[model samples]
Target: MNVMKRIAQSALKKTLIVAMATGAMFSTQAFAAEKVYRLKLAETWGANFPIFGDATKNMAKMANEMSNGRLEIRIDSANKHKAPLGVFDMVKSGQYDMGHSGSYYWKGKVPNTLYFTSMPFGMLPAEQYAWFYYGGGMDLMNQVYSPHNLLSFPGGNTEFQMGGWFQKEINSVDDLKGLKMRIPGFAGEIMAELGAKPTNIAPGELYTALERRTIDALEWVGPSLDLRMGFHKIAPYYYTGWHEPGSELQFLVNKQVWEKLPADLQEILRISMKTAAYDMYIQAVHESGKNWASIKTEYPNVKVKDFPPEVMDALRAANDKLLKEHASQDPLAKEIQASQAAYLKEVRAWTDISTKAYLDNEAK
Candidate 1:
């Protein structure tokens, strides 16, 4: 009976040990399931930049949902947490985990970065999206950012933009001289070359600057955003198709932070950006059409004019010269331009046959 009691006692001890181990395992799994991370995201534009705000909020929302609340992002607009132009470096240095801004904002740091934003007389929004996603443009962009300890993904895009809102008419190249213009990136440089003083100002400050006559001209996104900002009220002479042909925005992540993310999460970010990029482009195109109509009806005094053919020709020539000068100064600039030109050749062929043909017929 004692021996039987001893065996029973031993069995009971073994059972307790197993139960304890199982409990410990369950506790660890539960702890891991509750793990949470918070990331800081920044953008150059204010909350009013529709695509920037919308895409960013969408990304944060999707990430939270997918992660089951394990990951949360806190977004801060320009000067909310950092300066607008400082975003790229902040993300690169891990001061901020992520940023959403125009690639052109960092032209001083990376001259080739402007290609990701827009190239003068370059591809439109749809074509830019195709080039970046499918034509290996993103890979080339990564190459440019790699040295800076950054990883960039294409974010929202602003489709074809208006030439600008000018206080005075630009009938010829000579008219651009000595004009204090608020522009950015290669466009700004081209303006300076053409004798305009190109100044960089945040979107939020644009309206007041134009109102106070601090700037002679301003080029914001398009009619929709411009109308909302009341640019037409100040500069009634609106020109089309000169400065920014197509503008693309970007999502930049710190290389270290990006590398640390789970493979699946990294892919989720890329896919989300890719989807948002195209969606935002379409949204802008649709909104611009509606906004143009609204502008004509609401603001009868605003003069809407197509850029004269001579003006367009001169600007195009200046753009080409500016690009050549940039390529000469920066090897990366040359590389990006080469890639873009090559990809555009292929894209133009197909687009000319299909999309352009359809548009031309519709115009007639």
Candidate 2:
């Protein structure tokens, strides 16, 4: 009996030792694998620039929390970076691991970037989102950015951008002639075609430019943001949106930095950006409603005018002509235009029946 007991005890001790050794190996592996990644983002907007800046901040916060301290993102706004329009180049060169800006701002650098933002008479917010995620927009966007060593994602959406708070009303095609406006991207080209001198002024300088008569008219955003800028105080002739029906901002990532992230952290970052983007869209709608109400009551003297049919006709003609001319010059530009046009045609049909029909019914 004593001999049998001794042998059993010896065997149990050996089993325990093996188990302990195996657990130690796994613990060491885990210790080695667990890594914290820190990333820096540069944004085009000034610090705490409301809806736009909020998106970046929210994205960073969510990424940190969701990754359980594995991922840390630090954001530097235009004020800190001192380069509002340099986001694309910075991210592409790895100076910034990430960037928050509008894709359209990079049109001169990459023509395909123009199509990803709101085009003239383009799809609305929901429609454009569908086109991006479902209708090959993301793939097309990637096609445009990958060669540049950057990855672009839809950062946020400001539903409908107003035309401009013109110092004077637009009544005819001739009115656009010799008009100096602060516009950018495809719309700038269309305006140029119609004889308007369109230039891009940074947001911080827009008010001073307009006030000093450097720019005759300018479109910043809609009531959601325009109120804060005090555009109505000087340029009260607010025009309705014909350009940038649904303006979408962008997030850019350095390809090398992206590849450095673990699969889980990458997913967390992706989800964080998308959620914050959606939140910005909703907040824009909310702010517009509230501020628009205030505008109607408090700013009764401010004139909210739509461009006359003749001016609209001229714009559409110029838009069509410029698009054809520009698209013909670049194969990629042609492809992007074709995709947006096709997606708009398909999505607008459903939109007419659902949203448009509902709104039409409600307006009565």
Candidate 3:
């Protein structure tokens, strides 16, 4: 009986040893796999620059939380980086692991970047979002950026951007001629085609430039952001927008940095950016409504005007001519133009049937 008892005790001890060894192995593996990844991001906006800046902050927070502290992103705004237009180059060169800026800002470096932002007479915010996620826009955008060793994603949306706050009204197409306006990106190019002299001014100097008559007109953003800039005080004529109907800011990530992240972290980053973008769009809509109401009530002197049909026709023709020139110059540009045109036709039909029809009914 004593011998049998000793055998049972010895077998139990061996089983316990194996279980302990197996658990220790897993513990070691788990510890090694849990190493934190730290990345630095650079943004084109100044520190604390409203909706644009909030997007980066929101993205970083979501990524960190979702990754359970495995991912940490440090952001440097334009003030720290001192290169508002250099975000694309910085992320591509790996000076920054990521960047937050408008893709159109890099149009000078890569003309294809212009297509990812809002186009003149293009889709609205909802339609644009549908194109981005469903209508091959993401795939095309990747094709444009892959060569640069960078990945681009939508950072945020500014909704429908307002036309320039003009010191005087635009009653005719001829009024655009020789007008010096503070505009940028593809819209500025469009303006230049209409015989307007478009100048790029820093946001910090925009108010002073307009106030001092350094610029005849300027367009910042819609009521959502423009009220804070105080453009209404100086420019009484606030024209409706046609240039940037749904401007989307972008997030640029170094390809190498993205590849280095684990698949889970990569997904976390992607989802976080997408969420932040949609959130900004919703916020922009709410803010626009609230701010415009306040402006109408408090500032009775402000006049809102839409460009006359003749002016619109001229601008549209000019826009088409420039687009044709671009398509003639580059095959990729031609492809992008065709894709957006086709997608817009299909989507706008449904939009007209749904949103437009409903709104028209409500007007009655």
Candidate 4:
């Protein structure tokens, strides 16, 4: 009886140990499966900025749904969480997980960032997307951002942009002198070289500035945005086909946060960004077509003119000089330009045969 009791006690001890171990294993699995991550996204434009604003919302929604609610993003526009320029540093330091804005805004911090924005007479929207996604432009962009502990994705393009809105007719390059223009990126530099002073103003402040005559000329974006912002009421001389040929917007992610995402999540991000890029470009073109028609109807006094041949020639020459200077000073700029030019040469052939031909035929 004594031996039997002892055996029974030993059996009870072993069973208790087994039960505890099983419970711990189940708890560990539950904790791992319940893991969730939140990302804070910042954009330079306000919530009403149309293409960019809509794209940001769409991206966040897609990410959440595709992740099955495991990865969530909360987006804030300018002054919502941080200032526009502060976005780069905030994401770099992991204060925020992502940023959506123009690369031109950060040219002071990373001069090569301008390449990601737009080059004067550069690739058009479709070509730009091709170069970035398939022609190694994205890899070069990531290389430029790698030093700052960030990763960049080409989010969208603004297609071919208008020259700008001016208070007076720019019949010659001389008319540009002393003109206070609100342009950014390489376009601003080119403007400075042409004897104009380029000023940086946020979109919300643009209408008031133009109305008050604080600035003589302004280049916000294409017709859709310009019409929406009421630039037609302020500036009578609307010019086309100079400065920004194609404006590209970017999605910047913190390096650490990007590295932490699961492989499946990363794939989701890449696919979603590609989709947003194509969708936003299509939307811009569609809206601009409607807006141009409306602008002609509503603003009869607004003189829509193309830049003179001499002015366009001068601007293009100046742009080439600026590109050379940038490349000489910054190795990364040199690499990016080389990559862009090479890819563009390949893509332009097909574009010339297709889009260029179609437009030329339509013009006649």
lDDT of 3: 0.90
lDDT of 2 by residue, 145-256 (tens): 9999999999999879989889888888888899999998889999999999999987888989999889899988898999998998888698999998989999999999
TM-score of 3: 0.91
- Tens-place lDDT per residue, model 1, 1-364, is 2456557656755765687777743344433434466788988878656766887888887776666555778899885864887898789889999998888888887778878888777887778878887988989898989999988888877888888899998888888899999999888888888889999898889999999999999898887577888888789798886666678889998888877666767776667667776777777888898999998798889898887787778778888998888889878778889989988888889989999999999999
Candidate 1 wrong stretches, greater than 4 Å? 1-34
List model 3 lDDT by residue over 1-364, tens digit each. 2456447656755665676778733343444346579999999888898888888999999998877677899999888988888889999999999999888888889999999989999989999999999999999999999999999998899999999799988999889999999988878998898989998776667899999999999999899999989999899999999999999989999999999888989999999999999989988998999999998998888999999999999889988999999999999999999999999999999999999999999999
Over 4 Å off, model 3: 1-29
User: Model 1 misses residue 218 by how many Å?
Assistant: 0.7
TM-score of each: 0.90, 0.92, 0.91, 0.90
Query: How high a TM-score does candidate 4 get?
Result: 0.90
Which residue window of length 10 is worst by lDDT in model 4?
A: 25-34
Model 4, residue 110: what's the lDDT? 82
The better candidate by lDDT, 1 or 2, is: 2
Error of 4 at 162 (Å): 0.8
Candidate 2 error regions (>4 Å):
1-29
Which 10-residue window in model 3 sums to the lowest lDDT?
24-33
Models ranked on TM-score: 2, 3, 4, 1
**Sequence-dependent TM-score of model 2:** 0.92
